[model samples]
Target: MAKEGDGADSIVAATITDDAPTKAISSQGMESINATATAMTKAKNAIVVVEEACTSSKKPEEPKNPKTQVLIVPLRWMSLGMTRAKQQLVLLLAMRLRTVKTQMMTSKLQEVKAEADEKLKSISGENVLLQINCKALKNENAKLFKGYDDLEAKYTSMKALVKEKIKAAKSQAEAFKIELEATKGTNAESISKVAELLKSPPGFFKKQVKEYTTMVSTHILLVAKYLYPRIELEAIGEGYADGTSEEQALKLINDINGVATSIFNESLDL
Candidate 1:
């Protein structure tokens, strides 16, 4: 600004010098003075106009703005990346949980199968044991049956022997009864003498005869005790001694007496 002002002042000075020459006041000098005056007035007005423009229109200091501004796309890209990372993390966790669940299910299935197999094995073993027991029981039953058969055969033989003994004792008693009847009529004198001799030895047929005679006397007493109005068990003339089953009655009593005598004989053997 100072340089510009100086340049303008010098122009004014030169014009005055020219117009006011002065060899000193010539026609050139007068023209130079008039140009100088006009020029100076124009310079003053221009200076005033410039000062007003500078004061009224010039701006105050501006805030400094950076050469490069923040961009939108890169921020958006970062946010999208963060969201994708979160989604990946969640997916990975879910996949791991699924794998764990599958493994647990597989293990449970295997355990159940193992338990079932164990139970089946136990059942099979029990069945085998039961079969063996059944076979053993059958064998024992067969042996028991054979033992029963032998016992039955022995019982049958014993029954037959007892029957034979009964028959033999019955025949001997019948023969003795016949011999006593025959002697009763034919030996009267001998009977009197024997009775007298037995009475004299001591008392009651020499005392010992009473014991030996008791069984025969008891049989005769029983026949006479409940004698009926008539012996209706047989034909009127042919007596009970003539009846079909009379032999059985006689044999039953004889067998009882014989069994007693045999027991006495066994005492002598001992």
Candidate 2:
């Protein structure tokens, strides 16, 4: 009996001493905490009633009638009281365990949410940086395209200018070639006439000296304009009056030969 009383007292003391809630009211809600606290209070009261009964049973009683000498505690009543107190204690412990588990779950959920939010923020910052880089690259690409177009336009214009210069040079060369052919024809004709005059007999040349000088003067004016400027045209009339027409005619033929030879050589070089 003493041992059972001591066990009951220890259980009640433990129940009373360990009455702190495992979960906070913020996590479990005020209503849930209040209900849990009320249940713990009722369980504690039941344990206190059981402890009081056990303590009273250990006290010394007065010696009266022989039947009343033995302490008459209803076995069923004590058993029911102890059983209900134990059941309440078990229910309270289960409630506290459940509350502690819920609080732990809530705290872990908040931690996971915080980590997820941080990752999302980091990803968003990276995306913004990528967008900025992409925009700069696009602008750079556009500038390169514009510069390429400008260079291409300049290249086309320069090509056309070069073609125009080549065409004008070809046209000028053709005109010069036509003029050189005309001059070659005139020079050949004048050389053929001088050769015919040289073939004549010396007596016939002396007879035709005045006429030959006149022909030579006309040939100089027509074919060799550069040589014409060096000769004195008035000398032909004065030489005929001075009786030196043959000498003047022979000198004119030599000068015409020299001019024709130089013109033919220059044409061959061209």
What is the lDDT of every predicted structure here?
A: 0.50, 0.56
What is the model-wide C-alpha lDDT for candidate 1?
0.50
Q: Residues 243-265, candidate 2, lDDT per residue (tens digit)?
A: 65654655565566887656555
Best by lDDT: 2
lDDT for position 92 in model 1: 29
Clashes of 1: 7
List candidate 2 segments past 4 Å from native: 1-82, 185-270
Best by TM-score: 2
Model 1 poorest ten-residue lDDT run: 67-76
Cand. 2 TM to true fold: 0.39
Assess the local accuracy of residue 266 in candidate 2 as a C-alpha lDDT between 0 and 100: 51
1-270: candidate 1 lDDT, tens digit per residue:
112223323422443445322344446545643453344333433323322322332322322322111111121222233333322222222234345456767999999999999999999999999999999999999999999999999999999999999999999999989997775443445556977877678565455676555544444344544575454433433544545484475555455667556544554464
Q: Model 2, residue 218: displacement in angstroms? A: 30
Q: What's each prediction's TM-score?
A: 0.34, 0.39
Candidate 2: Cα lDDT at 76: 26
